[model samples]
Target chain A: MYIVVAYDVSEDHVRNKVAETLAAYGLQRIQRSVFAGRLPPALVKELAEKLRRVTRGANADVIIIRVDKRALDTAVRIGPALPREGNVHLH
Target chain B: MYIVVAYDVSEDHVRNKVAETLAAYGLQRIQRSVFAGRLPPALVKELAEKLRRVTRGANADVIIIRVDKRALDTAVRIGPALPREGNVHLH
Candidate 1:
């Protein structure tokens, strides 16, 4: 499954720490404060637990998104059909 | 740009309302509680504003993920090269 996790961290230190942990798990930083990756269910559970521990009391809002296998396939197949300009492609 | 919005709704009624609004904006529901879509920056801001109003005090965590044009293009271009079976593709 493809999962995208986004969080709003109140403290920069805590954000960096959490980002480090996620990077260790092979998550890619895709935006200013968002991360994306593909992981199995067990890995997701583990990552969520670690994140909860590290982000406790940091005043952060975390959202974990799971995109199923089917949607991912649809996206990949349709993506190439979309217009491409510079480096922008929509799937 | 490709954007994914995921939220945890405390109440079922509010969740449905918010989902309805998102669908009206061309966002496709890929999971039970997650929606995916492509939108411009202005549309994203407008959607965020409307989501805040509809989900006020509903005890939900909403995360908006923005994937840059370059990353999106990369994903699209590489997605087909990955393994494919049973409607699952990764980029």
Candidate 2:
């Protein structure tokens, strides 16, 4: 499953925590506050629950969208050119 | 066709222009930098083209994802509650 997590957290610390958690889940930071990656269905739920825990208080709005990999591949990506495929560089 | 548009633009004026363009396209600003709504595939392409034109010679990165309505309906939405369905307020 392909997941996109976008958050609007007012508090800076909470926002940083949310970003860090998403990164820990192996999701790539596609935008400033948006992270996208491929994860198992079970993992998606787990990630959501974790996000819920982190955003218990404070003004935060987090949206987790599940999109198909094929759809994402054909996404109309504008601006700076990024790798069409997943980013991998470990030489 | 549910579409999600997320952008990271450094310039304040350019960002505002991008946001205004997206709003004009009838996409709801889900997060600070993310807008999403249902749109026709052709409209999506049109929106992309318009975005491309607006983002010329700027440090901007925009991503447009096409996802199913059902997937968006079942999205794991956390923090501040929003309408499960579309926002309708014309009283």
Candidate 3:
């Protein structure tokens, strides 16, 4: 399973900490505020709880999205398709 | 259908233009390089082709992900769950 985590954080310190926490979970930063990678559902649940604590009281909104590869393989690319980071791309 | 569009473009001009094009298609920016919203499958194919054209060159890689709301409703939030734009929530 692929998890795409996106957040809207008001405090810089909390935001950075959230990013680090996501990275610690082995999620790759696909965008500035979006981190994504492959992880099991159980792990995702665990990390979501951790992130919730790390982001507590920062006036932040974080959403974790789960995408099956069937959807990703159908990914329509508009430019030179570079190899994506994990099971994100069909090898 | 919910479509999540993510891109990695090396050029600022192309990136901005691509973002504008996505916005024109009713896709909202959930993150810096990520956009998501409600769009039908046929429209997704159409917009994907357009994005491919707009993002041509500039050493960019763009991906479009489709997610069902059954999955979004399962979204676990750690902070204040602000009403997400479009068909991204259980409401």
Candidate 4:
């Protein structure tokens, strides 16, 4: 499953923590606050739960969107579409 | 069909115009640079082409993501999930 996580977090520490947690889950930061990657369904659920706990009391809005590969294939890009970090690298 | 249009533009005028064009297409601003909504496949292509033209000479990166309803239904929100604008309104 392909997942996109976007967040608007006010508190600095909490925001960093959220970013760290997401990175730990292997989600790549597409934008400053948006992370997207492929993960198993179970891990996706776990990631959601973890994010929910992190934002329980903070002033933050986080949205997680899951798209299948079929839908993702239809994605269109205009301008610098950077290669995602942590993807397979040729040496 | 659900579509997500995210852009990073360097010019102010072009940025505002991009936003206006996206709003005209009925896509809601989820984040400062991100817009999401439901649009037909044909319109999605048109929007992509229009955005492409607008960003042709500018330093901008725009991505259009199309997802099916089933994929979007799995979306999870943490914190203030605002009611979508221009959606069904009760009078």
Candidate 5:
């Protein structure tokens, strides 16, 4: 499934660690606190466990919202935002 | 359709304005720079126009990804994140 991971952590260092973990999993950073990409359900489950370990005893929360790939390809772009995949070709 | 809006803007005020706009449209902030909610397609289009206008002279980008409600309900929650709705339970 395609997922959008968004984190809100109280500490900067912890936040960076969380971001790094997401990046390590090959998720694209779409916003300061958000990342998105496609992953198999098993990997997502693994990520959830990894995230739990990273945020242990910290005031942090991360949500991995499932996104439909079709929806992502036809993303409703606003402003000058460009899709990472240039060939998506949606209006 | 349910949508998840994520933004990256250059200026603080502009970013706040963008967030305010999203909030006014009843979107829930899931992270500092991300919001998610259900909106009619017409409202989503209207939001795209408003975002464009707000970011006219700014170096900013916003992407709204459509989400399936079933997908959302079965969100792959990670860390200590809790769903906003306490009743819509899932594991």
Candidate 6:
């Protein structure tokens, strides 16, 4: 299943660290602080746990959202229609 | 512009109340606790502020995400490709 993880991290260092960890697990960056990827249940659980540990005492709030299959399909179809460049058209 | 609002409300009553307020302003429900709609900046700000007030002391956290035009288009295109029925395909 695809997971869309978002975090409101108060510290930039922690955010980068979390992103790096996610990248090691093959997650792709979708936005400034959002990452997306497909993973098995085990991996999802492991990653979530690891993230929580990494943010411990950092005063960061992380939210990992699981996207339903329907939403993932919708995102894929609509993602391409978005402008490929410029902040005005990108989000 | 389109705003995609998501809330993780701990109290069911607060969640429903917030949703009702958003519905009054023309937001359409996209998921169990997520709503999407197009509106002017003034309206979006007003809605967000009002939601904060309604959720005060309710032990709930509300997040109002502003989707770029590109993301909005992506959602629109992919939304149709999603399964029309069943939770398996709907998110």
**Against the true structure, whose lDDT is highest?**
2
The regions of model 2 sitting more than 4 angstroms off are: A81-91, B81-91
Worst 10 residues of 1 chain B by lDDT: B77-86
lDDT of each: 0.59, 0.80, 0.74, 0.74, 0.78, 0.60
DockQ category of candidate 4: medium
lDDT of 2 by residue, A1-91 (tens): 8888888899999999999999998988877888888899998888888988998887988888887877766777777655553221111
Q: For residues B1-91, what per-residue lDDT tens digits would candidate 3 score against the true structure?
A: 8877777788899999889988998988765677778898899878877877887667776767787766666766556645642225421
Q: Which stretches in model 6 have alpha-carbon errors above 4 Å?
A: A1-91, B76-91
Over B6-38, each residue of candidate 5 has an lDDT whose tens digit, in order, gives 888998989999999999999888667878888
Model 2: how large is the Cα RMSD against the reference? Answer: 3.7
Clashes in candidate 3: how many?
A: 1
Q: For residues B46-79, what per-residue lDDT tens digits would candidate 1 score against the true structure?
A: 8878887887767655556564333333331101
Q: Write the per-residue lDDT of candidate 3 for residues A1-91, one digit (tens) a residue.
A: 7877877788999999999999998888755676777888889879988987888777887778887767765656555545542224431
- CA shift of B54, model 6, Å: 0.7
lDDT of 3 at A67: 78
Alpha-carbon deviation at B68 in model 6, angstroms: 2.8
Stretches off by above 4 angstroms in model 4 are A81-91, B81-91
Question: For candidate 6, lDDT tens digit of each residue in B23-89?
Answer: 9989876655566678898887788678868887776555455554444433311112234321221
Ten contiguous residues minimizing lDDT sum, candidate 5 chain A: A82-91
| lDDT tens per residue, model 1, A1-91 | 5766656667798878778977888877644455667887789778878887887777655556564434333332111122431121112
Candidate ranking under TM-score, highest first, comes to: 2, 5, 4, 3, 6, 1
- Supply the DockQ value of model 2: 0.74
Pairs that collide, model 4: none
What is the full ranking by lDDT, best candidate first? 2, 5, 3, 4, 6, 1
Docking class of 3: medium
Displacement of residue B33 (Cα, Å) in model 3 is 3.9
Two-way DockQ contest, 4 vs 6, winner:
4
Put down candidate 4 lDDT per residue, A34-60, tens digits, no spaces: 777888989988988898798778987
Q: What is the lDDT of candidate 3?
A: 0.74
